[model samples]
Target: MKGNETPRSTLWYFVVAHTFWKNVEVESFLSEYRFTIVIFPTMLKIYRGANGKYTLYDDGISLDYLQGDSVQTLIKWDDVAKKLSLEPASKQTATRTFQVELIPDGVTKRIQYSGRPVELKF
Candidate 1:
């Protein structure tokens, strides 16, 4: 995404999911979908910044979705099950973010993400 591109200017929704893992080296599947991390989970509680960015407290690791060429790409899930699989493991504790375009007439109705402004068409 371009620096000049105001994220809120476009019609989009943010999806957040989280889970915990005992001893798994999970590669956060972020770039596959378009989303900037507002917070990431760690051994303890999740630490979120005032600006909606996230980081792992103890580990000092931050989740950045806008650093690479794959940041603007969209991911396709075959079905609801597939989408659920993408969610962070609920048992442990992790946070994942996803950006979805709003389609007013789609069968799966679109809902606005909190704090995001909505654009109305006349």
Candidate 2:
């Protein structure tokens, strides 16, 4: 929740990642380069199992987004960097919510999204 540190919860990360990459496009060339095609964005969900393993759900994302279920084939975190990299040119009226959870020393902390990132305190 600070700097480059994301929430440890896979679910939270997944939601963030999904929202960040909600609108993505891919372009490819057809055989002989006669035609070009645009690919649609896919929906993806991520969660952590009780065993501490990460599980990804791709029911919403199109086939273009997945090479396999394994994390390696899934889009990397950097893929959505542009979305998360936005900087407010000026104070806007629009706002959104983001949630964060932290677990340390057997203690858990929950933080709610309050629009501006400056309001967030890890």
Best by the lDDT measure: 2
Tens digits of per-residue lDDT for model 1, 3-110: 533232212223223221111222222353574533322111111211121221221244433342122211223231212112211123323232222223222222
Off by over 4 Å in 2: 1-93, 105-117
Query: Evaluated with TM-score, which candidate comes out highest?
Result: 2
lDDT assessment of candidate 2: 0.28
Q: What TM-score would each prediction reach against the true structure?
A: 0.17, 0.19
Give the local distance difference test score of model 1.
Answer: 0.24
By summed lDDT, which 10 consecutive residues of candidate 1 come out lowest? 42-51
lDDT of 2 by residue, 1-122 (tens): 34433332212233342322222344444454355554432322222221122222332346633554321111222222211111223233223222222222122222232223332222
Q: List runs of model 1 lying over 4 Å from the truth.
A: 1-76, 79-85, 89-91, 102-122
TM-score of 1: 0.17
Instruction: Provide the lDDT at 65 for model 2.
Output: 31
